[model samples]
Target: MSSSFQANLDEDYIPQNILLTGGAGFIGSHVAILLAKKYPHYNIVVYDKLDYCSCLDNLDEISRLKNFKFVKGDISSPDLVSYVMAEEHIDTIMHFAAQTHVDNSFGNSFNFTQSNIMGTHVLLEAAKCHRGMRRFIHVSTDEVYGEGETFETEAMNEEHVLEPTNPYAATKAGAEFLVKSYHRSFKLPCVITRGNNVYGPHQFPEKLIPKFTNQLLRGRPVTLHGDGSNTRNFLYVEDVARAFEVILHKAKPGMILNIGGANEVSNLEVAKKLITILGKEDQMDELISFVPDRKFNDLRYTINSGKLHQLGWKEEMSWEEGLKTTVEWFTKYSGRFGNIEDALVAHPRIGFAPGSSVSNEH
Candidate 1:
C-alpha cells in the first residue's frame, strides 16, 4: 500500500517518513518495531541488505503494520540509496547498516570498509540531497573509542578521542567523521549515538551471550577468551531502542550522545549469569573452556550516558532480568537453531549451521 503520510499543499512542513537502514539486524529491528508502534501516523521504511547476521523474520511483527515497509537493498550503492530516499519520501534517516563483528573484520577488513565507511558516505551524500530532512541519526558503537586504561574507574563520554584498535572500530570511527563532515559542509541536520554492548531477542548467536548459551544448550563447552576478564556494559536492546526514539525527537542538531547501560559486568560473569538463569549452574565449571584471546581484545568498555539520561531516558530493565528474558527466547527457539534449514537462514555465511557438524572456533 502507498504511504498515507504525504505533504499537504497547505502545510508548512512535510509529514515525517523515516528511512531506517539495517532494520533487519538486531538493534535496528527493535528500533523499527518501536517506531512503528509509537508513531502510527509516520511512515517507517526499513532498508536492509539481509546479510548473514540479518533476518527478515526480525521484523515479522511490524511488517504488516500500515506505517511499516521493508526494502531489501544495500546502502553501499549510491543509486539504490538515492532511489530509496526519493521513493520512500524519506524525511529522516537512521543509518545503522554496518559490518560489526570485530573477529570477522580482522579477516575481511575490506568488507568493513565497504559497508561501514563507504556505505555511510554514500548514504550521507544521499541525505544531503534531500530537502527539508528533519534529522539524520547515525548509530555508532562505544568500540569507536577503543580501549582505555581507566575504564575501571572512568567512562568514555562523547568527548572521548577516537583510538580504534580494530578494523571494525576504525571503519565506524571513519563513518562518524563522515557524518560530522556532512553536517558541517552541507548543513545536513544530524546527530550521532555511541551505544554500549546491547543484548536482547533476535540477536545472531555468534556474539558472546548467544554463543555461550547455544553451547550450553548443545552440551558443548562455552569458550572463554583470555581468562574471560574482559568487561563490558550490557544494555538491553529495548532500552537502546527507546534511547533512539528519544534522541530522534529531542536531540539538537550536531549532538553526539552516548547511550549506555550502567551494568558493568565481566565476560566470565556473563557466562555464569547465563548458566544460573538456565538452571545449568551444576555444569558451570565444566561448561567454561578458556581459550586464546583475540589478537587485540580490549580489556573493558564503559561509557557515560549522562547526556542521554538528561534527556529523560534511562534503562528500565536490569542486566539480570534482560539475560533471563534472552535465555528464555533462545530456549523457545532452540529447535530452530538446531534445524539445518533454519540455521542456514539465520547464518548463511557459515559453511555449516551454528550447532551442526562444523566446529565454531570463535
Candidate 2:
C-alpha cells in the first residue's frame, strides 16, 4: 500500500463506506482502486448503469479486493440508488456519473439532460435522505464556464458564472446548481471540483488523447476538429484522481475548486507530439486532418489551480510525460480501439440542430 493509502486509514477519515457513482468508468475506476487499496477497512461500493461508455474491464483490477463492491444501477433509478445507499452504509458520496461527451450532446441533448441533470437530481435526493452520509463530492467539468477570448487566467474561482456552451456542459452546469442548492437548502455537505481534460491509462479510447494515439498506432488517419488550434489544458488521469482524493480529504465544504494541469497545448500540437513520440512522424502531416469543428466547441480552456494548490494539492504530471504514458497504455489495450471508433460514430457532429439555442443558460 502507498503512504497516501496508509495515511487515509491512519487518520480514520475513511468513510466506513463510500458510494462512487460511475465507478466502473475511466476516472471513477482509478479513484475507486486508490481508495480501496488505501483503506482496506472501509467498504467501497460502486454504483453504475454500465452505459455503452462504461466498460467493466476498467474495474477488473479492483474487483477482487475484499473492500470493493459494485452495484449495477443508474443514478436516475431512485429505488436502486436509495437501496444501495442504505445497504452499503455509505457515508461518502462521490458523484462522477454522467454523459460527458460534448459532441454526443449536440444531436442528443435530451439524453445528456436526462443523465447529467436528472440523474444528478436523483443522486442529490438520495443523499438528502441518507442522514448518515457525511460528504458529497460533485465531480464536474471546466466546460461549465464556457469559452473565453483568452485562457482563464485567474483560475476559475467558485464564483465563476455558469456559461456552458454545449448540451453536455449545460446539463453539467444545471447539476452543479442543484448540488449547491442541496448544500444551502438541505444542508448537504457537498464540495464540487471542476477538472480540465483528464487523460491516462484505462481512459476510454473515444477521448482525444487515446483516440488519436490509438489511430496512430494502428496506422489510421487522426481527425482533428476545426483547424485544431483550440487550446486545452490536459490533466493526467492519476493526477485528476488524486485531486479528488485531496479535495475529499482536506478541502472545506461548499467550495468549488479548479483542478488543471500546469501546461496547456493546442490540439494540433498534441497530435504532432504523439506521432513524434511514436516514431510515426512520416504519417503525422498526412494522417492528421481537421474535420468540421463540433457545435459550440470552446476555443481555449485553461484553468488556474491556485486554490487547489493552496490547499496543498498540485498537479505532478507534465504534458509530455503524461502523453507518453497514455500512448503506452493505449498501445497495450489496442484491442479496445475498435469499440471506441464505433462509439464515436454514434455521435456525429450535427452542429446545432433545431432546438439547440445559442442564447441559453450555461
Candidate 3:
C-alpha cells in the first residue's frame, strides 16, 4: 500500500487503511469515532500533536477498538508523517491538523502558517511519495470565503472565490492552494471541504458556543465582540461528522465541497438563545458584556452546501436541540479541560510576535 493508487478505483473505491491527522480534536474525534464504529474493517490511525485544545480523552470511545490506533507526532515533520503513512499502510488521509482559533491567529500568526500551511505541505509531500495514497481530504473553514449577508443565497456552489481577511483564514486558504497544486500536478486525488462553525460536546470551550456555555454555567458574564451583529452558520458536530462520512464515501479527487448549516444565527442571537435556555433572562443585563471587535471580523460566512447535500448529506440536528444538549453536557462535565479560566476570558490570546505583549482584545 506504500505505492501509487490502483488504476481502476473509480467504480469501487473502499478505504482499507486511513490516517486522520489531528484526529483527537473536536470535529476530527467525532469523525474518528463514526468511521471506526461504522466501518469496523477499516484501520483508523489518529495522528495528533496533542495541542492544548486537543485532548486524547476525546477519543476514549474508540481507543480500545481493534481498528483504531493512536500515534503522537507533528504534521510539520516530514519524516514522522512519512513513517506513519508507511507503517500504517495508509491509503486515504483526512488532513485536519491546523491552528484553528481565529483569535489566536492574530497573536500567533506564525504558528498558524507553520501548522496550517507548512504542515499541509509535509502531508501532501508524504502522500506524493507514497503512491498507494488514494484520497487526500483537506479540511478547511468557511471563513476563507469572507463575509456573506444573512439573507444572501449560498447557492453559488463551488465557484465562489476565496477572500480570507484574517490571519487564520489566510493560512487556511494558503493550504488549499497547496492541495490544489498537488492535485493538478500529481493527480493526488485531493478533496477539499470548507465548513461553517461547528459546536457540540467535548469542544475546547474557546469558541463562542462552548465558551459562553462554560461562563454562564459558572455564573459569569459572557463577553461579545462589537455590537454582536456578526452572523455565522453553525452545524452540530455530529452533523458535521456525517458530512465527512459522506465525503469520504462519495467525493472524487480534485473536488471541493462546502459544509454549512441552515441555522444562520447572529452572535447576539446565539447569546440570547443561550441565556434563555439557561434560565438567565433576569441576569441578561449583568451576564452579557461587549468587547472590542477583531481587527477584521467577517460579518458572515454562508456557503452553498448543495453539492454535499446532493451526496445525500443533510443536517439532522435542530439548532435548539444541539445548543441545549451542548449546554447540558458542559454542566454535567464542568471544567472538562481543567483551569480554563483564561480560555473563558474576554480575549485570552496573546501576541507571540517579537516585542508584543498582548494581542487585540477583540
- The model with the greatest lDDT is 3
- lDDT digits (tens) for residues 62-89 of candidate 2: 8999999988887888998898898888
On TM-score, the candidate that comes out on top is: 3
Q: Against the hidden true structure, what lDDT does model 2 obtain?
A: 0.77
Error of 1 at 213 (Å): 1.0
Per-model tally of clashing residue pairs: 0, 1, 4
Q: What's the CA RMSD for each of the models?
A: 6.9, 5.7, 4.8
* Candidate 1 TM-score versus the reference: 0.89
Local distance difference test, candidate 1: 0.78
Clashing residue pairs in candidate 3 (N, C-alpha, C atoms within 3 angstroms): 3-131, 3-132, 4-131, 4-132
| All candidates: TM-score | 0.89, 0.90, 0.93
Compared with the true structure, all predictions reach lDDT values of 0.78, 0.77, 0.83
lDDT of 3 by residue, 90-194 (tens): 999998878887887887788878888899999999999996999999998887877775456554456687788999899889999999899988989999988
By TM-score, how accurate is candidate 2? 0.90
Mind giving the per-residue lDDT tens digits that candidate 1 earns over 1-362? 01112222242323389998888888888989998998899899988877766778888889889999998888878898899899888889987888777766666677778888888898899988877577888888898888866655588778878899998899889999999888888889888888888887877776788777777777777778788888888888888889888877777677898888888889999989888887888988897788777779888878888888877799999877899899899888755333423221212243331111110111
Residue 10 CA displacement from its true place in model 2, Å: 13
